[model samples]
Target: MNSHSSDKKGILRRLRRIQGQVSGLERMVEDDSYCIDVLTQISAATAALQACALALLDDHLHCCVADAVTRGGDAAREKVDEASQAIARLVRS
Candidate 1:
């Protein structure tokens, strides 16, 4: 029933990589790595998270929003509104 069900496995794999990046970042900080080195790792982690967000957004639009629009009526409006809010949050981040 999930919007990203088709690619759930792929998404999870990416998430796990991102999680590893974060853990590495924490280790870098704990080990007192050079400032620039820590910053580079942070950037990598941030980019990974952003990519994950975008992928999920694409899946939501193609699956959940598409289905809602096809059904028509209030469900479509709700989905559109929900998607808009999600986009806004993503952009703000």
Candidate 2:
């Protein structure tokens, strides 16, 4: 039911990779890996997640938002406001 249903598989794949990275980070801690090394991996994982969020946002704009705007009514304004809120959340995060 998502606008990005077409990208679901790819997004899930990336999330799985991020999950693996998190596991690796956990293992690194268990094995007493260097702090900087662990932090580096953490940073990489964070960036990957942010990239995924941005991609989803882009898809929402192109698909859901576009469709709502095409309708040209209260729904259009609502969709735009929703998008702005989403962007604000992303930026704040």
Candidate 3:
């Protein structure tokens, strides 16, 4: 099973909310909203996305990485590497 299965609903809900926020941002742009206001909304949306990423990373460490460590050998090393790459991407972002 997926590591985040337990949080699937919550993650989806967060994503849906972000989607709405993006739509609202589009409308604001279309209506020529103030620059600061648009930038603020963009920041809020970015923060929400980061929050979701953090939650998923937590789940991955607790579930996927934990499981891989238990299994040992190549699987364990692969999981560790995958997690490292994920962290790197998040850091770059």
Best by lDDT: 3
How well is each residue in 1-93 modelled by candidate 3, as lDDT tens digits? 384566988998999999999999999999999999999999999999999999898889889999999999999999999999999999999
Give the per-residue lDDT of model 2 (tens digit) for 1-93.
394565888888989999999999999999999999999999999999999998788888988999999999999999999999999999999
Off by over 4 Å in 3: 1-4
Per-residue lDDT tens digits for candidate 1, residues 2-82, read 844668888899999999998998898899999999999889888988998888888899999999999999999999999
| Residue 8 lDDT (model 3) | 83
Local distance difference test scores for all models: 0.90, 0.92, 0.94
* Candidate 2 total steric clashes: 0
Output the lDDT of residue 89, model 3.
100
Model 2 scores a C-alpha lDDT of: 0.92
Q: Which stretches of candidate 2 lie over 4 Å from their true place?
A: 1-4
TM-score of every model versus the real structure: 0.94, 0.92, 0.94
Ranking by TM-score: 3, 1, 2
Q: Of the candidates numbered 1 and 2, which has the greater lDDT value?
A: 2
